[model samples]
Target: SDLPLLCQHFINNYNQENGTTVKGISNETLQLLTTYHWPGNVRELNIAIERACIDARKGIITVDNLLRFTQNVSRQNISSENYRGFDIKEARKEAEKAVIIRALKASNNNRRKAAELMEISRSALYNKIIELEID
Candidate 1:
């Protein structure tokens, strides 16, 4: 697939322009990118890789970085075709985790505040955090 090559090319460009030594994309991140339908094609992929590079740390583009990229740029572009082979349970889990993480961040990691933001009880939020295995 051209995805890896294109991702590497974008990562190389980011490293050169920023003087950052982002080594490469993680296998998990690559898998996610490959599975994505990329409705916008190469141009969308390029932007996603660039966004991932900007958010990347610890020398590699991670699933977290790509998740953020997708969340920000492709939320409006999602389609049913993207869910063709995806398990509904797993998709729901991922969506829940993303929302919980976003709430945590918005609340500065304060469980009570995050729970309030989500209109859920603190204990419920705690249970979700444990179930989701969120750090």
Candidate 2:
């Protein structure tokens, strides 16, 4: 609703202002944002957005950037040292996959409801599950 409109606005201005043509993070970022149950609420989103914008030197926000925020939102600070013992990238992906599945289940598999529960858009959630290679 209001949130999609808001992100859309960000997408438009961000491209114009940065001249980098990177699509706004909404496609993937919104799914990450909306599916979290938003216990911490919009303040959390603001902080995440600020961070993404700060990191966007090229204008594009990759899935990697969103993944960083995802990890942050989950507070999974498994520490770089411990992750060295295992395939850290795979481990993180697995953990993130679990989080999305749990969120979907909590919302009864209704992607829209799940997105709302996560504070994201229905379409964004669908796109992300595919993008993340989540079954």
What C-alpha lDDT do the candidate models reach, one value each? 0.74, 0.56
Residue-level lDDT of model 1, residues 1-135, one tens digit each, is: 888899999899888998999999998677767766777898888888888888788989976676555653323322221233456466546656776788799899999998886667999889989997999
Each model's TM-score, in the order given? Answer: 0.64, 0.40
Top candidate by lDDT: 1
Rate residue 122 of model 2 by lDDT: 78
The Cα RMSD in angstroms, rounded to one decimal, for candidate 2 relative to the true structure is 14.7
- Please give the range of 10 consecutive residues that has the lowest summed lDDT in model 1: 73-82
Where does candidate 1 stray beyond 4 Å? 72-89, 109-135
- Choose the strongest candidate by TM-score: 1
Candidate 2 lDDT by residue in tens digits, 17-135: 76645556635546445544545566655555544664554665544454444546543322221133455455455655655676688788877877775566778778879967877
